[model samples]
Target: MTVSAPPAPPAAQRTPPAPAAPRRRRPIAPYLMVAPLVLVLAGVLLVPLVRLIVVSFQKYGLDQLVGGRPSEWVGLDNYGEVLAAEEFWSSLWHTVRFLVIAVGLTIGLGLLLAHLLAKVSRSVRVIMLLAMVMVWAMPPIIAMPMWRWLIDQRFGVLNYTLFHAGVLPTRSFNWFSSPVTGWTVICAIVVWGALPFVVISLHAALTAVPGELVEAARLDGAGAWRVFTAVTFPAIKPTVLIITVLSIIWDYRVFAQIWLLRDIGANKDTYYTIGIWSYVESFSNKNFGLGAAISLISVVLLGAFSIFAVRSVLRTAQAADAEADAR
Candidate 1:
């Protein structure tokens, strides 16, 4: 006997899904959990920023510090003074130049090394990454002094080696003798320290890149440069922009490397960035108000320069992430 087959249900007669349960609202637990960190940041960052803004408007100095006198609000006089001073302008130009050279070299080298790291075997990559992390973990306070010793005029390894190798005519070469040579050394140190972080960041971005896209490019007869410019760069563009801005901010405010390398007796002015100059003015010259003003001015300048770029790149990075997740 043939069994009767059940007929399929009509399309319109089938029950629809239960409408996704209306996507329950995200829990507030995450925000609540982060409240402590927010409070800590406000205490750490906002408090000092508020104090700085207040001091920027006042004539606060050693006299006020010792005598307990109320700080007299000078109403932009400090700003005017800083704007009119040749020293501020000169120091500013020096800082700007340093920022350009240091950041450029750091990023360029970091990108090269990151690409090299990505191509290496996994074991080699892990070993090199650990070495880079060690360098990155070193504090500037310790590293700068070591670097200063390494480039010392009479006994520095650099000068000694160069002299022995006949790369130099003299047994000793003073790196701090001139601004050009001094800045070169400082930038070299800064770039060397910054390289690990930059390379790590770019390498992370490189690892996130899709292998299939790269393979497709290569299979289409695309050369290395063409593949990089077309496929590889788009994946890492956001990271590059973000790193560039951060490098600008970091290199602009470099203090230790410059301060340590400078000669205590002289040639200090020749290598002073705004940060070093600010410290000297604040403590040595005892011009607290002027130092605060200069510090504020530098912050404003850097903030203005990076604010727009930061917001734009963050959005681009987020979008890139979403696209990657979709893939």
Candidate 2:
């Protein structure tokens, strides 16, 4: 039996090892597809932004823009002039004041509207949503004139109504005579225009909140405000923070409303913000260099604010994630 075993096959006669499957090269199809969009953005946005930064340091004017002459390099002289001017400081202060008031009112009103919309019936909600969308869709140009007419000194319906209702001592109270009254009108207009978008965002965020959590809080004897603070606000805090930052940005750059309403009073210069100042410096005064410097300063300030807000939001998100994981 030991000698009966067949001799082993030779190595050369054995089956060849199976050839390795060909390795696939990494696919670059995605990059190839997105290349067109990247090119368009570089041409449209990046190029112009770089040119703007370059022009900010040069004494470029309508002549240079129209190819009449080469721009003179002024280095930081334009920035120095802008910083030295009292007008720049005044405009900056006005801008800051307007931003604080408008942003506060817009956010507070938007949150209230969102809460109301969330508690409404579907049909009512649809109607309110449509109204908000309509308001949001209106152009600033149209809104400015409409508001102006409504607050007009002689023919305004507001004065007439208030006088007839005995809320005013006179039928023709000059609303724009004082700086306080003028700014109040401007802030009101900005807040009104900005409300719809904020409301829509906040409503969507509120809808995403868990109903069961709210119900549990209520069952534990929590009131409406308490339930919102305890069970709902934590969920929507990130969204609120984002909307607030956006509102700040939008309100900070408000120009049309203030500009259009400027001619209503003799002391309208009191209402001038950075936007108006930039326009005046660039177009009216024809000091393009100083104007660009002012604009750059504004951009830098806004960028700083945005960076701070982003860091705060990231911290909040990380904290939320940690808390979630712990649970």
Candidate 3:
């Protein structure tokens, strides 16, 4: 054999990529499965959103809807009109006030309830929880009228009792007659409706607290108050934050109670929020543009709140997860 490299075997041909593992097609599978849901959401939500945006620029009225097309684009005129109006600003302030009072009271009451419920026997806890849930489960319409009846001038049990007990001069004091009083009643209704959920969430979170950690705190000469502040409180702080954010969002969108109160006698001009204002402008005044603009503004404010809440949640969750992983 010639010592010359026996005709060097051609470099073994690279086996072509092992056929790419049959291209396990999964990414597009998830998308295909979700396509129906995407279509449904687009039809229900996005379509209306697009129309609302368009109408926010166009002039549309009930009569126009009956006989014509949207004729003109007002550019920023609708927004300017809303911003320049005093009621718009007033309504926004009222909404913030309502949210602060309602959410504060709700959280406070909920925390107290959760704490109390945690110490009670199981039977008693269930009874109390069921009672609270009854209030929460009641529809706003039902609760609104019932609360109104309770505060009614002549027959309201509240005023009647106050008068009979000599706390009031007469039974003629109507809670919804004054804006401040009406607002307070509305806050109470909202708190009553919202507190149950917070209580339930917080109660669960509290129960999840490690018993050994609590025992250790107690053995360390920590008083009940100190143990709560240092251990139990910190553990439940995230739950409280979530509850507060939810309550704020709920109170901000409250319209049924406020609207019913307004219908009963509360001054629309005095007791208003972005929701009520948008409704009145859109339906009563036939100002779709103004209504949409007001709604968009409200959405912007809510979006900001949601962003803050989400960021807070992410931070807390990340911290908890890190702690868990470290353990």
Candidate 4:
């Protein structure tokens, strides 16, 4: 036991633990894959946005635009001018009116169509859905002109039918001569064009509703209206809200339809929505700076509305989740 302890296992033979291998870094393949998309989006969207903001602050004119030279910096002058103009307020009012009427009618009709599609036989539903898809696929530019032709003052199918049916006092009735009629036609066109997508989306949402829940409600002697209000609606409420917000945004910024049909009205000024006004200022009037300012204001207003809608929806959803958790 006292033997020299085998010389303490010779120091030279002792082995120390090796340092851990450096952690292999995560592969950057994912980031590399997305880099191109990020670059493209920045170029297309971010660049233009920055230019718009910059132009809005400057006194940009045709000379500056053509020469590619920086214009005089007019701090807030463009914004001030736009805000002080009566035309801006008038255009805003027109936009609001169009948004309200078009969105309301579009959503109402979409819900009706979605409900009908949900109830119908598979074949009929498929046929109706296909028809809707066709309409939705049609470009607005093409559809707008087609509508104009159909309602034209001369040789128009609508006027011909109405006159023959005794619904019109004259064989050639001018639909666009009066502001009331012009706006009505415009709203109708927007509603018709928007309906297909809304209906399809709502139909899809409706189809996701639990059949058991609906049947249970029915077995409990709940009427159709009661069953829909209590069971079906709650499930699709979020979808409806989202579609309504989207519709509002779409109708708020409607341009091609209004612009194409502006001259149809006796007073073209009557149809000057914010979109039309922006175009007129930028292109027609060659006041690019003022137009950009108008556009920025419109964007701010729409953005505010969108934020409110999103927040409301989120609150409702969170409250629902909380209630479920408590239950």
Evaluated with lDDT, which candidate comes out highest? 4
* Per-residue error (Å), model 3, residue 275: 0.5
Question: Local distance difference test, per candidate?
Answer: 0.87, 0.89, 0.85, 0.90
Instruction: Name the regions of candidate 4 deviating beyond 4 angstroms.
Output: 1-27, 67-70, 322-327
Of the candidates shown, which would achieve the greatest TM-score relative to the real structure?
3
Q: List ranges where model 3 is wrong by over 4 Å.
A: 1-23, 27-30, 324-327
Residue pair clashes in candidate 3: none
Q: Any idea what lDDT model 3 has?
A: 0.85
Cα lDDT tens digits, model 3, 124-222, are: 999999998898889998887788788888789999998989997878986767788778888888888888899999999999988999999999999
lDDT of 3 at 321: 75
**Which sections of candidate 2 miss by over 4 Å?**
1-26, 62-67
Q: Kindly report which residue stretches of model 1 are placed more than 4 angstroms away from their true locations once superposed.
A: 1-35, 318-327
Better model by lDDT, 2 or 4?
4
Model 4 lDDT, full chain set:
0.90
Q: TM-score of model 1 relative to the true fold?
A: 0.85
Worst 10 residues of 2 by lDDT: 47-56
